[model samples]
Target: MSSRLALPPWLRVAAAMFAVGWGANQFAAMLLVYRDEDGFSSEAVTGLFGAYALGLIPALLVFGPISDRVGRRRVMRPVLVLSIAATVVLVVGGHSLAVLLVGRLMAGVASGAAFAPGSAWIKELSADRPGGTGARRAALALSAGFGSGPLVAGAVAQWLPAPTLLPYVPHLVLMALVVPIAWHAPEPAAPAADTSRHGHEVWRVLRGRPFVLGILLTAPWVFGAASTSFATIPTFVDVDVAPVAVTGALCGLTLWTGAFVQPFGKRLGDARLIIAAGLLAATCGLLLGVVVARTDLAWLLPLVAVLLGTAYGLVLVGGLTAIELMAHRDDLATLNAVFYSLTYIGFAAPLLSTLALRAVSPTALMAIGAAVALLTIPAALASRVSPRR
Candidate 1:
């Protein structure tokens, strides 16, 4: 039966990435459920969302190196269980912000462990394929999980008993199916970095102009643009009818749009160009967000979502593709880790913007985000990214 259950190597690793991705977002739309029940402020709810980053960043910093040393399967198999446990924590969190915060933190840890290593694992497993296939597969799987998680969670939370608890059940069941297959997935060789040849390679790459200007400059907007599209933009509109489900749909719209855009981005051929185009799109989208926020327009939310989602999808794959060109085999996971950590910085955008609402208008804040995105374009273009073949 175990033999019968084994999935194709790359597919299984992709599945693990997907499952963790699903776990990472299952609670996103549930913010509405909590806020509605407890009368929590938007600030409090977004803070709960940001708590995931506190755990994720440290785990991301640690796990990539750990996986490079230990082999992908060793790290990934266990973390899937960790993800399940995190979901269990959320399942019973009910109305307690403290309990929900802990659950989110745990989910972040589980996600940070999987993301870089899983990206590297799937890339390694797809060595025989075209260069962009690995990155596209990774992006597609993660985005699919990201989009669907909220959609399902939102739907169940909107209509079901125990909204928070039941919303998490799908991910738990998903992991039970995924973990075994991932456990049996073939292991890639442990990527051992010899210090003599590549002394402190991650730092060395970090210092390179391309890495700094190309990736770091461009990465933050990846999620900055994304989080604002679904989380912040929707807050500007009042959805009295099935608001939670509507929030879920916004997440799905944003992420699924991004997932579908990867292939077109890949075809654009030059990773740097894609990154630049992405930043430009984000800038435009942010500017549009300013309009949406001021006009109190609900119909335009989908437009902003589509535009920002395009930015997220493009930069994400472009960054990964750029890393593929930049990093050595041994440092792939480490660089991936760095890239992901930077991307999560943007995840804080909604929270920051929510807090900023105290000092400035939402229109002004979104315009500021647009300005930042516009400034990033030159940095991305000036980046000495080796053109993807």
Candidate 2:
């Protein structure tokens, strides 16, 4: 909101750090495949995989506001270093699923710490721009980083020697690069006006009406959209809907559409409108997926993938932007953490859908997911599109 918050070179460096940590997104996707390859039980894999969200949610809640007191760089630097540490652990301990889980938990903590404040910082730094360029750039960096993780990891897994080892190896290299940059990154001075607030205030903030509505309208989109690409697309390939390469392509499309297309979504001037449009698009995609899957129309899968992918990108960007606009500037990190918590709730959809697929047709599973998306549309539209207070 202040001119002092204008973008600077150091902000870009911080954004890079934020983006690089998203390699875990790619790792999350590949982990399921890896579990099957390594002969881990589905239950065991699910437990191990869910650790990221478990660690992330609490860290996000605890650390989000801490940055306001201690300073953004203070929180981010250590988290980035920890992320580097987790990458090392990932490579050194790949053979042990237990160690892998710990590394993921560590990575989750680092990401949760960095993501909240980092997003807030981005918006703050970009506050001087005419349009909400800072918000848009922050959204792109976050989405791109998450999106690119799969492409980079998937490519390495597909082509390089030592499929397991190669994917993480690149992350280690990126972490090395992120350290020096994070060290020198500039931050807005911590709120000079410090009021020593006690416990439960954070929870009170989370429980506010708009924030609660934000969670309800946003969660299903997060779960449904992420699962469409990560959970269901691969299954579609297995059922002969399309080739495996298409999965990667669709994943890329989903993320890229979210990252690049979001600038336009911002122009719509209402987060609720953008989210509603995205939900409707995603619903169509999911329903079409059901149709194609049930009818055995393999070629239709890619088209459906495109629809879901684009819709996901739009919803992700709009949802986050809405969160940013909805909260106080100083509260950005906490709000972001809360927003990500909802997203990770959706992130869990894949696991639930995995269990559901055992009992229902994959088509039915996707159709149900589509129905969930449809349900969100009306709620998003009905929600007031007020800018962040």
Candidate 3:
């Protein structure tokens, strides 16, 4: 590998963002292990899954504006440290449910603190790059990290020894090295101005029809559909059709597709159209999820991944692009944070799916989700009519 010093500032920041995202989703594959080994109930596992959002949302609301006031580096450095701490907590605590909860909360805080600032830093560092390139790079880094975490964890947990301990060890090592690299990454000379506004300002911006509707129609479904496709659907599949390793790979496939497709979203040249198309893809994919679950055609999981991944890519990039166009430079981080905060709602999909299963069959639940996705199309289409700020 090349020396850390030789890597560009944008790459370093991207690496840090990648680490944050990886940490956020690393536990997805581990949920099954906990259930089997520790005798955890399905509800307990669901709680653990949702715990990341518990820590992430508040952190984003608070740290985003702080990063806007202070430079990005100052905010990112401590969050990177917190990320390392979270991994250590996970490694040391082993299968203890309380410890895992705390570790996940810390992981959420680190991700929330890092993502918006790190993304804003990438944009500033790549100031000379073409339009939407920075956002594309940021999304790719995050998707790769998020997708790979579960894949690596599942593979190691299944084939390798020390299921819990070993999976996090590599992340610990990577984060430790990334700390210094992230510390050295360059910051913009001047931070954004008007950083002292109250929370009302953020709310005021959210009131905009374009920003609110764009997020409403796209952001939550991106991860919600992903959770359905990757996390929930795999668990229910027959072991013969979807082995443990194969499940992880499918999760990775979904995310990697999202990461790779983002650049083409830039090429598509219309954020509104991308959002509309993404919602349509998601609707079809959710309906297919019902079919995949009912028919036991695990072979079709890849097709499901493609649909969900394409939705993830187009909606995420298009939504971010729309938000960027509407936000003031001074409020960019806060706006990004706000957008992401809503996005985290999708992370609750696994938990919600679990509960919904009590009342309705998986097929019925997926059909309902597909209907919800379909209903959002009008909002996505409406986004085009509003002029970009």
Clashing residue pairs in all predictions, respectively, total 0, 3, 0
Better of 1 and 2 by TM-score: 1
Could you tell me the lDDT of residue 327 within candidate 2?
Answer: 65
lDDT scores in order: 0.86, 0.67, 0.81
Candidate 1: where is the Cα deviation over 4 Å? 1-6, 190-192, 387-389
- Specify the highest-lDDT model's number: 1
> How many angstroms is residue 361 displaced in model 1 relative to the true structure, after the best TM-score fit?
0.9
Per-residue lDDT of 42-154 in model 1, one digit per residue for the tens? 88899998889899989998999788777888888779989999998887777788998999999999999999999999999988898878888988888888888998999
lDDT of 2: 0.67
Ranking by lDDT: 1, 3, 2
| 11-79 per-residue lDDT for model 2 (tens digits) | 564556445546556565455446645777665665665667777788888888787667777887788
Best by TM-score: 1
What are the runs in model 3 whose C-alpha is more than 4 Å off? Answer: 195-201, 385-389
Residue 63 deviation, candidate 1, in Å? 0.8
Residue 261: error of model 1 in Å? 0.3
